[model samples]
Each structure stands twice: as C-alpha cells, then as structure tokens.
Target: MWPGGTVRDVAGLWDVALPAEAVRVPGVSMAGFRSRTDRFVDMQVVPYPALTLFVDFGDGRVVDDAGSRWMDSGVVGLAPGGARGRGRSIDCLQVRISPLVAHAVFGAGAEFSGAMVSLEELWGREAVRTRERMWEAGSWQERFAVAREMLLRGQSEGPAVDPEVAHAWRQMVRQQGRVRVAGLAEETGWSRKRLWSRFRSQVGLTPKRAAQLVRFDHAAHRLAAGEQSASVAATSGYVDQSHLHREVRAFTGVTPNAVAQAQWLDVDDVAWGRGRAGARRLRVG
Candidate 1:
C-alpha cells in the first residue's frame, strides 16, 4: 500500500492515482501521474473543454513543440492547438476545472482563451509554494488533498460569474453544445450583444466559440472511442461528415481518424470515468 492510499499502476508506464469519490469536489477533477522509469516522455495533448492546471513534482522538464516549456508547473487555456509534451521522468498532478468554476477560481480578468501560461504568471510565489508542498507530501492522496484545499480556497476567494453566464454554460454542457446563443440570451433575460460581450470577458471565449468548442470536444471523444466520423457528425450537431472532418482539422490540426488514434485520449476511461455526463477531463499523453 502507498502512504495515503493505493494507486492504480498501469503496465509500469506511469502510476495513476485518483482521489476518493467522497473527497471529489464539484466542478473539479484531478489525477496524479508519476513515471515508473526514465524513458523519454513524448505525447500529444488533446484539447478539452476545461481549464487545465499542471503541478509538477519531478526533476524532468516538459516542453511543447512550439518552444514553450514548463519546468515546474503551468496552466493551459481553452483550445491551445497542436501542443505536444516532450520530456522524461514526468511526475505531476493534473487538474481539470470547469470554465464556470475556473472563472471564479482564477478571477474574471485571467486570460485562458487560447494560451499556455506559467503558473507563476497567475499565482506568483504561491505556485511555487504549492508545488513544494505537493512534492513534500507522503503520497498521491496527500498531494491531491493539498491541491483540493487550494482549489477550494481559491474558489471561495475569487470573484463569481453572473448567474446567467453559469446557466448558459451548464446548458451547453447538458445539451452537448447544441443549444443556441440567442435562446440562451432569451432565457437569461439579456440581449444577445450583452450576453456575448459578458461571456467573452468572463469565460475567455465568445458564446458561439464556446459552443463550438464543447461540440468539438464531445465529437472528438466519440471518435476516440471508435465511433465513425459520419455517426459522430450526425449526432454532435455538425452539418455533415465533412463538417466533422473540417472541425476536427480546425481544432486539432489533424483529421478525425488521427484524433481517434491519439494516445492522449487513451486514459479518459480510467481517469475521468467513461460516459459520465458533463465530466470535463483533460488528456495529456
């Protein structure tokens, strides 16, 4: 047994640990990964519909193909395209927070539209301290506890989004991004222009773009699960199979078939639970 809890070790590639369900906070999910050997780590990171936070605890460094590097920890924003992580001996706690909750946890002014930022830029010295604390923890469960405490504190202290904005986002998730922005505006009792501007400022994506992203994420996962492009397109609010292909290409710079075979998505069932409604999980291969 591990110090705090038993970790599910998978084929010795990496050790994956999850928090107890009782301790799981709403709107937040996290998984801990520790490399079992010194092999080189290289993998594609598929975009998901949540704000991603990485808390690093290993000696190795992870850098993307685009020249951006995170030696310690960092945050990845919405729709960060074509970024692949390359490293060795990787160890980190990966947290996925819903944009609705993230807006409050990171504050309204935080930029996450389509960028990767060092944790220091947003959390300053606190980021370093948090990393140190997690590294010092006895086990993955302890580390998850520390991270959960931090998120709870941040969410409690941060500014909240408008209730209408939260409602719209929930609706999008509930409907798998098939809802209309104009309909959301009417439901929220706000004008289209007002809702559009507010959502952009608060969530870092326009309502329409956010809907598209949600739709894309759902479709991508479906493809990853071996569903045909035509079927996914038909059910995921796309105009046609061609539309699905184009969207997969636009968001990931790859075809739907390529996305289906992406290694990054291989762990979703274990980490996020398969077919759980509204589970926003991040995938870094």
Candidate 2:
C-alpha cells in the first residue's frame, strides 16, 4: 500500500537463493534468482558497496533505462557499485563483486565506477564462451560452479590492488564508513595526496565518496527496516535528519520515505539471509 499505488510491491514474485560452498569465491558472493511470475517487473537497483555481475539464465529480457543493450541469455552485465539501473523480468544469477576482487578479476577498476557494460565488451569473445557454458549448465549449482571456476582463474592471473589501499577500504567497511580519510592515510604510511590518488585509481572512487556510498547504503537499509529517519541519521553518522535526507536523495533520487518503502530493499530480507553475499568486508593481509 504505497502512496498512490504508483509503486508495485513485487518483491515476492521472485525466488532468491544464497550461494553455497560449491560456488563460494572470496571477494565475491552469489545470489541466484528465478522469477515466479511472467509479468514485466520494474527493477530499481540501489547503490551497493560492490560491483555487480548478472548472468541471465531465463528467457525474459532485462532492458535498462539508459538504452544500453538488452540483457538476456548468452550475455552478462557488469554494473559498478553505487550505480543505478532498471531491468525488466529478470531471471538471472546476480553476483556482487567486491572492489578488492574486482581489480583482480576485471582489472579495470577505475572504469567501473557508476558504469555499466556488457561482459562481452569487457572480456571479449571469452564472455560469449563463458555464457554458453553457463547457459548449458543443467542446474543453478552447476552454473555457479562454472562461474566460480572462471572467477578463480581470472583472480589468479590478475593484478592485486595495493595493500595499503586494500587496508584503507577494509577499515572504512569495518567502521561502517565512519572512518576519516586522513586517519586512513596516516595508518597506511602514505601522504594524503598519494593515498587519495591511489585509492581513486584502484578503487574507482575517492575515499570520501566511497565512505559516503557505504554510509548511505547502511542508512538506506535501516530506513527500509522501519527505523525513524531522524534516528537513522543520528546513529548512522550523518549530521542530522536533513543530512540523511540529502544523502538519500543524492544516492537514490528519491525522498527518505520513498527509499524506505522501496520494493528492492524488501527483497534483501528474503533473497539475502544471514550470510548476505558481500556482507562481510574484505581484509588486507
């Protein structure tokens, strides 16, 4: 019963399965999804802390609002974290890739910020070959295995992010995005300028922006869970309710109330259980 009934609460029209050990890959997590209804569904992707990869196994199409190529079987989509887009009738295995792992697997970290590109564009013909295997897999578990192997291979061969940058990223996540950039620079033994440059180039976002995105993500979930806006603001590190309002509107293009009632948030409760993929932050060794 959203205002004016303009927003349809269709979060229940899909089944979401968390990844099991067979498909487990560090720096990433999987959420398998299958549509229960054939009707067209509107997708409002919230800003997340990890880049997303979508492997469509079903016959339905996923069309984005930005006039990007339509997504279907035989193709996969890669959207950077904090990016927003819409899809329709999506029946896909969505994987959230942590930036720490995205660099090793995808290599082009800076290019992914707020960007969306097809795997074919990023990985070339290999993308086609991989999608073929995923499409041919007899079950979701099999598909997950294929994906896990592919990621493992890429991760093994790809370059690693700088250890200091990795540590800074982890500290932000550990602190729930309340950590200061200057303190992170100090702890990493790098000058503030150097830290900012390296972090931006490797992680695809400046330290402050990354922290804000993470903070906004945490606050958004709290709002969805029926917390008062003012309380969420105070507890989540914002200046006040007004600060929270501005941040929510900046990230989601909606009012605090609208984000609270977002159907997308509602799905997290069911689609993502206790071991929410990418819920655990990465650590620097």
Candidate 3:
C-alpha cells in the first residue's frame, strides 16, 4: 500500500514447520476452496508428493504463465483439480528462498534458467511425503526437529557470492523494511537493467516488486496475529493508514480487517512470496 497499491487493515498467512524427516502435507486446503466465491488469484497450484507450497504467485492479473510474463489484471489464476465444501482453503509455511542459496547448491549457471527442477529433485516426492507423515505423527518439537534435519541442516547450502545475497536479504527484511531493487544492484555493482534481467530469469519478479511483496508479507504477519491497523502499519514500516490500505488491496485482495477475519489464503495469498522454488547442494569453500 505504500508506493505500490492495496493496503489492508489486517492480514495473515501461516507457516508450520513440518517434521523434517518424513512428512506428507495433505491437500486439506483444496477441499476448503470448494466454491467459486473462495477462489484466489494469480497463483500456481504447485503440488508436491505429500505437502504443497501454496505460494502467492502474484496478481494472476499480471503474471501470465501461459505467456511467460506479466499481463493484465483481468486475469488471475487457474482453479485446482478439486475444492468443494469438504474442508479448508489452501495454506502454507511462510517459507522463502534466495538467489544466492540456489546458485551455491544447484550450480552457478542453474539460476539462469528456472531452478525449480533441481529443488524438486533435492526434496523428492518420497521424501516430501515422508516429511508430511512425520508431521501428522508427532508433537511440534518432534516435527520441527524432523524439519530441521531434513530441510534446515540437510543438503541445503548458501548462495554463491562474496557477500551472500540471502544473508543480505534477510537483513533487508529486518532493516530496509523492503528489498529495494536499486539498492541491491548498487550493493552488487550490477546496473538496474542487468539486475532486473537476472532477477526475472531466476526469481520471477523484478526487485522492487519482490521487495513490495516481502513488505506486504511483514504486514500480513502482524495482522494475522490480530493487531490493529495503526500498530500494524507502524510495525510493518508503512507510512500510515492509507498506505496500508493501498498495499493490502494490491496484494491480499482484502482489507486488514477482512484479512484478520480470514485465516487462510489460497494460490494468491503470498503471490510469488516464498514459492520461488530453488535449493542447491551444500557447497563448501
């Protein structure tokens, strides 16, 4: 809502650390989004063997998967294979990946093309399903341990850079309150044009847009916890109330209050937030 658009009163997205060792994320959300009224926008229903990463791809209006680029707002997303009054809307663990991490694990040049293939291979279907099963079987601690071993401390590695972009980005999340494209380019010594090209080839969105998404996510996190608009805006780094509304509408497609009332998001929730999909083999010096 700040400089871009659609700020809400309160919004929230959830993340659960599944048992790392063996887990199978059931398609509980698919069942919940049965009616057309519950449909979300600009998302890809990327399914894994056990659990699925409900990534908020973008305003289905802008990103044209078929066209392979951004388009119009009238369009949004394709419906999943199933979703009736049976259960709940799709949800996910608010996870994210960085360009540096992918380059380090998959191989430097892999990021030039989509890095998702290698990630899918790294966290294979069987392993993914196993992780899900483990989650359903244990306490939160047990689930976290499994996830830590399997994901956090497993084969995952850092990105390839003198100064890790992933580390820098996490800082950006904390300090800048947004991942500014121009700033990243300046820090990396890449021209804005070069930066955008490389970023799109790898992460999907350009830098400024990605930063906005990250910012929106921060606000959504606060809102999800039942915070008020004024506090949410301040904590999330928004300038004020109007800014919040603008940002929320552009991203969440709902207001802060509405988002507070709602608990889950489907394909469009995080909108290309954390579902960029790239993990590399552990690389050492």
Candidate 4:
C-alpha cells in the first residue's frame, strides 16, 4: 500500500498533500494540491526564494495574471511580480528547486530570471511527455516519483554552476541572508565584480537581490505564523518594523499585515517543511 498522506486544508478551499516520505534530492521539495469543492481558485502566488515548477494533471485549466494559460506545466522564476494563479478543479504537483540545483537542472539560469515560462519552452516535447507520464500515475507517490526521476535526469545532463558561486549562495542561505556580498566574495576567493557577474548569470539574481529575497521569505513566513512584525523585523535583519513593511510591499505589493494573512502561505509548514523551528534538511552539495 502507498504510505498514507498528510492533508491540510488551506482556508477551507484547497486540500494540500504532503509526501509521506522525504524527497531525497538535494535542494528540492514538492507538494501536491487539489481543490476541495470545484470552486474556482484565484490564488495569489507569493514570491519565494526558489525557482518553482507547477505540473497540472487534473482536467482543470490554469492561467496566470500574465495571460499565459497551461493545462500541463509552467515555471515561475524568482520574484515574479504580482503573479496570481486562477483555475477550477485544480490538481497539481508544485516543486520548489533551490537556485543552486536549478542551475544544473534547468541549464539556462539567466533566461528564467524574474520571468515566467511555459515548460514547453524550456523542455520542448519532453515537457509534454513528462506531464503525460505523471498524469497516468496511480497516486501522488507515483507522480512524485516520476517528477523526481525527470529532475535527476535533468541534473545529470545539464551544466552546473561554478562551485564558488554555489558556495556563496549556500552561505547566504545558511546565514538567513545576513551575510554580506563582500564577505562572500572573500570566502569564495572571487573578486566582488567577478562574483556579482557570475552569480547573476548562473543563479538568475544578483547576490544582493537574492539575499533580499531570502530574507524577505523568512520574514514573510514568520508574519504568516502570527509573529509580531516588529519582532520579526528585529530578528530577520531589518532596520525596523517599517523596514519590514517596505520590503513586504516591494515584494508582494502589499503591507506586512496583509502578507501575514495571505492564503498562499498557509500551507508552508506542511507543504514545504518550513516551520517555526527550522526547515527540512536540504542537500546543499
């Protein structure tokens, strides 16, 4: 029998399924989602630090604010401005790939920087084939397995980012985005100029932007978890609660209080294993 799944209701509208077993891939995590009542879902896509891939297998139609519609799959890059997902009867596997792994798994990192692209554009016909295979799977476990195999294959075949760049990224994440760019460059033995250029080309965001995104993500989740904004800002490396408010507005076009109530973040602990205690262990190397 397939392992029993853990389900959580998001605002009583969607049922989220978390994998019973941890995905073994480094720098990757996934969650399966399905609508509960055939009601149309108009979900705000909160920007996060990683590259995201959404594979739809249900009979529903999914479209974004940018006017792109897809029944199969699409990729969301870092900091996609004001992206919202709209659809009915939706069922999909959402995968979040750390930019470090994305560099190898997707090959052309710069192309995805702050952009949304259909999977067809990135993987060509293989995108269709993979979606079909997942659609044919008997259970979420099977679908997750199929997706994992596809990512492993891509990682093996695609080019990798420079190790120095990878190290710098890991540092930023480890420090919760508090590490300085100059310090990272010194640690990587790359000059500041070389590090900035190479990191942007490979990771799809400048080190400073990536750090800001990471810090913002951490703060957003805390806000969602009901922490006081002032406390979060103080501990999350912000100058003040007002600074937190501004950063939240910059990223989501909303205030921190508004972000705290966003439905999209309601499932983070279950779906992404990001709880107040800590995050699920990710394979950094």
Candidate 5:
C-alpha cells in the first residue's frame, strides 16, 4: 500500500523538494528527488505542464516505455511532458521546465513535444560535464546552485517565444485548460486556422491537446486528494464520469481509480510539499 506523502512499493521510496533559486526562473521549477534506498520507480509517468529533465546522480539505471535507453549516473534524460518511462534504482534531481521557458533555454521547444530524448542530444557534451559537476558537488544546495547557473546561462542565449503563443498558453494554464480554442483565437485577434498553425508549430501539441493535458493534470491531483470521480468529472468540465475516465486513460493508460493511487502523484506532497508553490498534499489510505 502507498504511504502518506511518499510513493512506495517493491521499488522503495523517494524524498522531494524545490530549491530556493527555482523560484526566480519563470516557467522553471526544480524538485530534488533522493531515493530512500537503492530501488526502482515503475509506473506510467503522469504528464505535466513542462519538460521533465532528470539529472541522475545515483547507482543503477532508468528505462522508459519507448526504448532501451538506460539512464544512469553522469547521464541526463529528457522526457517531454506526457512521455512515460521507468526507473530502476534511481536517485536524482528532477527539474520541470515549462515549454515557454524551454525555447529560451534549449532554443528548440517545438522539437521536444510528445517525445523523449537525452539531454545530451540537445545539450551535447555539456550534458556530460554538468552531470559530472553535480555529482562532485558536496551537498544539494551546491548542486542546485550549479543547475541554476547552467539554466540561466542557457536562458540568456535564445530568442523568446512569440507573445501570442505565450498569451494563449497562459490562458490555457490559468483556466486549468478549460477554455475554448476559438475563444483563444478571438482573444489573440488571430483567425482560428492561424492560431492552430502557430500554436502547434511553437508549443508542440495543438491547442486542443494542450488544453486536455492541462485539464487532466488538475483532475488527476484532485482524484489523488480523494475526491469522488463523479464529482471531479462534473467540476473538471467533463461531460460525465466516463469522459473523465477516457481522458485519464488516454493520457496515462490507466483508470481513474489507478491514477488516484499513482506513485507519481503520491510523491508530490513530499518532494514538492514546500518551496516556490508551497505544498500540495493529499491523504491516501
């Protein structure tokens, strides 16, 4: 069974938190996850609103559903939001970088949408050097400082995303993905076709898909909080409980009940329990 504020099974458990510098970067938040023991995290990755970067500093390896890539120490794995993977005896610092900030940092936000690639592919050998530095750092605070400097330097080099795309994305996030695409077009003074073309080009997912992801993220956490599925469905803009189920399944390949007990969501309370956004905890029996 799952314990409060932690995700555990045969794979063991992890402790998580956000560093102080994480708050200064817009569209960037870092969650430090340290394994309680040498173990694995086997679960479908619950999609989030940002690019997930794992800076591994532990023993063993991590593999995802899509391929045979085994991410080990001195390796940096990049899973675009929504990509699922597996971790075996993993201990690392996980950073969630919003796609909005991604373009400015990685210089290629559109390339990562719905895909998983190693940070080495994008950052090249710099990925190797950074991982080495992280491992050498004496403490989490020093490690976090190294990470912040690298990202901030990268952020200084690239062009920003279009203001229109930023505005549309902001609306989708603010409404918890409940807003209509046509309304976004109208508000941006762009035709529906134009909005669709541009949003997809820059943001990766189409406007509709992005909104669905945002909605599912909010509802998944609510369900984990022990809210009844039917109640969550009604308030989450679903036509019915079945609609919520289908969406949840589509996003995570799991039932609403399973998502409520997901190890991925369970760790949020402990790892992200405090810091920039404060703590979000839910009791699970």
Candidate 6:
C-alpha cells in the first residue's frame, strides 16, 4: 500500500524551485526501509552522473550516486534510481546542481569532474555542513534559510576557475564537439599537464574527461526515456555513434544500450555495472 504523504521537489540552476506532490508508496511503511536506505551510505558503488545527498527519516544516511560515474565516494550499492519508498515520508526538497552551478561555485576545473572530494577540503575546509539542524522543530522554510546562508557564504570568495576555461567548457557542451584534452589546455591558456593538475585538484578530474562524462550523463537520461543511442549521439553532438559508445563505456564501464535496460534499478541487482548509482531499494513486497 502507498503512503499518504509524498512530495518530490527539483531545483535547477535558476535557484527557482519546482515542487512536486509527494508519493506515499502504497502497502509499505517507512518502517520497512529503516534497514537499507536509511543506513549511513558512504560507499562508491558504480559510475553515473550527479551527487545525491539523501536525508531519510526512516533511517539516517547520505547516498551519492551518479548515473554514469558517481562521485569519488566509495562503493555502497548500485545505481541512483532506487525505488524503495519512505513509508510515510514528509515533504522534502532535492536539488540537482548543474555542472554550471558547480563551476560557478567551485570554478571551471572542479565542476562535474567525475572524481569528487569534500568541497571544504578543496578550498581549505572553512565551511560548515549546510544541513545541520539549527532551530530544530520548525517550518521547512525556516530550515531552508539557515542552510542557504551557509551555502552562500561558502562561495563568497576563494580559489575559482579561470573564466576562459569555464567559457570554453560551456561552448563545447553547446556545440557537442569532440573532446580533446590538449586542445582544452590551449583553450584555457594552460599547458596540458598544468590544466590536468588544477582540473583534478579543483574539479576532481581533467577537463576533457569531465566533459565527456557530462555529455554521457545527458545521453543516458535521453536513452532511458527511449531515445536511441545513435539518435542520442546526434542530438547530443557526437561525430559518430561509436564515439558515444566509447565515451560512455570509459566513464560508466558499460555500453549505451546496456544502460537503457539497466535503467530500472532495484534494491539488489542492477542492470549495468554502475557502482553507487545502481542500487535502489524498491517496494517489492
């Protein structure tokens, strides 16, 4: 049986929040999931895109899963699209930060670079955890304000990405052009070796590598929604279909077609070999 309260909220780079009605998974209660999804989740399972911070009342854990390659976090489970419901979950907010947002905050080199470390460590660790309960027992709006303050201050000033490199990254995405690590170095006015150094430290991966992952991320989403791989390449801007396959395989360790069938992740076995993003606890009983 589904629960009564279910709200899904999505946030984009605009800072404009979009709210969706919550879903109370029928037949199952949050009690059922208090074991798995609720445990402390700090394992890097597979590869995908996106870093997820989960706050589950059923238990208490933070899960980071990317569709292609997850954050540099260690392995815990499978894919990110897990379906286990939160029994009677209250309304909560989820924000999917775009690469641009990460770039804006962390600078060009570190945004969506596949590899990841705590944001604090990169900039010298002067930041506090944004989600610590401050007022305790208050409206969600009040809690949001406290978190926003910390987030805003964290990005006030410090190490930042070079504007030219940042601009080049976006242009490449817009054009769907080939990813060339050496060329990206020229675009950013840094030697290839130098670029990789800053890029890895700041963003967690090299520029070319990160861009390809981001591109593959979009393609996976499209394919899951029924867009064919060759077609996915055309829309996302690949020179040829095989190019898309290699890029996806390098990042995700799987081919494009495999990901489509692998889209429906469960609590246990996953389709593709995605480490973290492949595990989802669904309501099977």
Give TM per candidate.
0.91, 0.85, 0.46, 0.89, 0.84, 0.54
lDDT by residue for model 3 over 169-240, one digit each (tens)? 454556644556677778778777876666544434445654665676666655655578899888777889
Candidate order, TM-score descending: 1, 4, 2, 5, 6, 3
Tell me the tens digit of each residue's lDDT in model 4 across 193-256: 9999999999998999999999999999888777999999999999998888888988888888
Write one digit per residue (lDDT tens) for candidate 6, span 9-73: 11110111221123211111111122322223322223433332223323223333333332221
- List per-candidate RMSD values in Å: 3.5, 8.3, 14.0, 5.3, 5.5, 10.3
lDDT of 1: 0.78
Q: Choose the strongest candidate by TM-score.
A: 1
lDDT sort, best first = 4, 1, 2, 5, 6, 3
Clashes of each: 0, 0, 52, 0, 4, 47
Assess the local accuracy of residue 6 in candidate 6 as a C-alpha lDDT between 0 and 100.
Answer: 25
Candidate 1 regions exceeding 4 Å error are 59-65, 108-110, 275-285
Q: How good is model 2 by TM-score? A: 0.85
Badly placed stretches (over 4 Å) of model 4 are 1-12, 20-23, 59-72, 275-285
lDDT of 5 by residue, 1-285 (tens): 112222322224455545664334666766666656534456556777676667766553445555555565322222233344355545567777776777777765445576666768778888888888888877666666777888888878877878888899999999998999999999999998988988876777788988998898889888887889999999999999999999998877779998887766766655544211323332212
State model 3's lDDT.
0.39
Residue lDDT tens for model 1, 1-285: 145654766555667788876557799988877777776666667888898888766654545547656545787788878766655666778899898888877763336676777878888999889888887888778888888888899989988889999999999989989999999999999999999988988888899988889999899889877789999999899999999998888888989998887767766766776432322233333
lDDT of 2 by residue, 151-199 (tens): 8998899999999999999998898899999999999999999999999
Q: Model 2 residue 110 lDDT?
A: 62
* Candidate 4: C-alpha lDDT: 0.79
Model 3 ranges off by over 4 Å: 1-125, 128-146, 152-164, 202-204, 225-227, 234-240, 264-285
RMSD of 4: 5.3
Judging by TM-score, tell me the better candidate of 3 and 6: 6
**Model 5, global lDDT:** 0.68
Q: What is the lDDT of residue 168 in candidate 5?
A: 93
